[model samples]
Target: MCPPEHFEVSYSINPWMEPDKPTDAPLALVQWDRLRARLVSLGHRVDVVPPRPGLPDMVFAANAATVIDGRVLAARYRHPQRSGEEPAYQAWFAEHGYPVRQAGFVNEGEGDMLPTGARILAGTGFRTDHRAHAEAADHFGLPVVTLHLVDPYFYHLDTALAVLDHEEIMYYPGAFSPDSQALLRELYPDAILADEADAAVFGLNAISDGEHVLLPQSAVHLTESLRAAGFTPIAVDLSELLKAGGAAKCCALELRESLPSTERRREPS
Candidate 1:
């Protein structure tokens, strides 16, 4: 049963994160409560956990992992300090009624997974690795498309690319590899391009609902594009999160499941 492929998606709370280089920029506790409230209001069932001390950035706990089918595939984080998250994640999934499975492969939670349609794209090379790509494809029946990580701090795939609607994926090409481009083209022929600089300004990491895309106020052209495509765009100020390298989008929300999973369909990564 463990080897057999199965399931879709679910969401969870992020612990918190701290920057390694910056000593002055503190991780705020007040923002976390507000973040939790916002997500819970969106009708998500949130399960919060306290982060262990000293690991200020530990709250952005990749150990929490993603669930597809009935299985909890443990995420393999690139940072050594994050490796300890797996044991807890595996146990959490099993206890929560999900079939638990360990992935020897390394991956970043948000960065590695692009689960849509029947295809699931897994990002590697920066916060994740090749082992992750192979394991995800083989174990989960999802074709793992590898995305190359470019730029130093754009450590996760979510940093440069995001899938908005079934047919739309937002990308920052400067960070893409040749293989990544070809793979994306095969899956999405009509992908709208958002420049790397623009994407870095919170253009690409924007999240989506069936009729709306929540974007940063700064993305004028992209916002217009969304409206033209019949989407109501909501803007939120993610200045505090963005200052810490997160966007208005990535800082809080998790794409847990598509209500009508069959209608939206899944795309390969």
Candidate 2:
């Protein structure tokens, strides 16, 4: 995780960003610290990459890269505002002994690529291009299930859905194209459908450690629903960070060892 030492929404790229809106930097830092503490408390190891000036959104480390097995496919952001972040993230991976691979396509890393044990759910239409999914399939040797996001509010797949292991998923269907929604139903019929109110507040962006779920404090209903499903919910107030279009899950990067070598899933010709 990169510290929010220099975080500010100086420019607008998505519907959630507002350059005129004021952000509470101090509050953002405190919230980040609490998130870090919560992750550690839940028995997860935390890593830090020093924050750099002019790269405020670096705090959203999930956009840094997509790591499958030990190979790091660094992000090539669509916006110039975030493109500078690619080299820094790549450097961090190299420093930590992970092999960094150059991505030949435009992809926003984990922001649009979510691994669901059985497959990688890749999102396109906003931040990531469909071509990136093909590149990822070749690089990681995992089946890439592509979904197109239609709602501009849910620019990234991670913003619209959260993969809770391979069996269960919670998502906002309205954020997806009708075809994608149908595909989702075909893939996971019993997936938890997030309500509009909670989804608007980025509730579906919550992080689940299998047993414990870290979500936005405002998602009261989602919390209860999670409990009913036998998962403990930990509400965290990342309101300040929300101003810049990220919350609990968006700020943290999930690191993994190299995926076991496997055959590639179906790719578009």
Candidate 3:
């Protein structure tokens, strides 16, 4: 039988986080509702899990690890405190039946898993480490482009680079090593350079659903350019989420499936 088409996703209403961090309740609620509506409009079956208690900051939804081919690799967050998140995800995965795998040491979440076609440009430094990249390549059967990050602000790889389409990417030059930059230039000479200001808004955390791109309402020019390129640009507002360092593009998820059986799942690897 074909696996279920519906996806199961979890969220943490309470996070072991800085209580002082400001939260815009109305804005966040609006953003979450829009995401649900967009997914439904695209014909995706979404399963929502209330955020685990005490993981309130889980609203910065990208902390979950990346997954591919049923191998649910857990994330090792950069913030020492955030590392505590993995065990919870692991437990959640076990209960949910997603396979268990872990990123290499000193790593963090899926924000570092930048997919370029079949190639994995795994980031090393604040969020993810080299060992995780190597192991990830082994499990997923893909080549890894190891990027040694130098800046803390650009801790997550997704913050600096993202795949726009199958053959196109959006990247910021300063965030890349010279060799990676050269390689990117060689591969997609026509790829766009995402605006630094916009990337700051975490707009680069765009969703490329194998075709159209789900972008941010704040990125007007880039959104127009994306539409010009034939992508059905879907803009969502995420300002309240951004107050805690999250943007609309980064709030949702990308669910991968196991091959052959090919059923979609919620938990990450």
Best by lDDT: 2
Tell me the TM-score of each prediction against the true structure: 0.75, 0.95, 0.80
Identify the leading candidate in terms of TM-score.
Answer: 2
lDDT of 1 by residue, 125-176 (tens): 6667777778777767766667776565556677667767654676766667
Poorest stretch of ten by lDDT in candidate 3:
1-10
Error of 1 at 31 (Å): 3.9
| Model 2 lDDT per residue over 138-225, tens place | 8888899999999999999988999765457899999998999999999999788898899999998888866778999898888888
Clashes of each: 17, 4, 16
lDDT: the better of candidates 1 and 2: 2
> What are the lDDT figures for the candidates, one per model?
0.56, 0.87, 0.62
Better of 2 and 3 by lDDT: 2
Answer with 1 or 2, whichever has the higher TM-score.
Answer: 2
Q: Tens digits of per-residue lDDT for model 3 on 48-82?
A: 54465545445544556666776776777756445
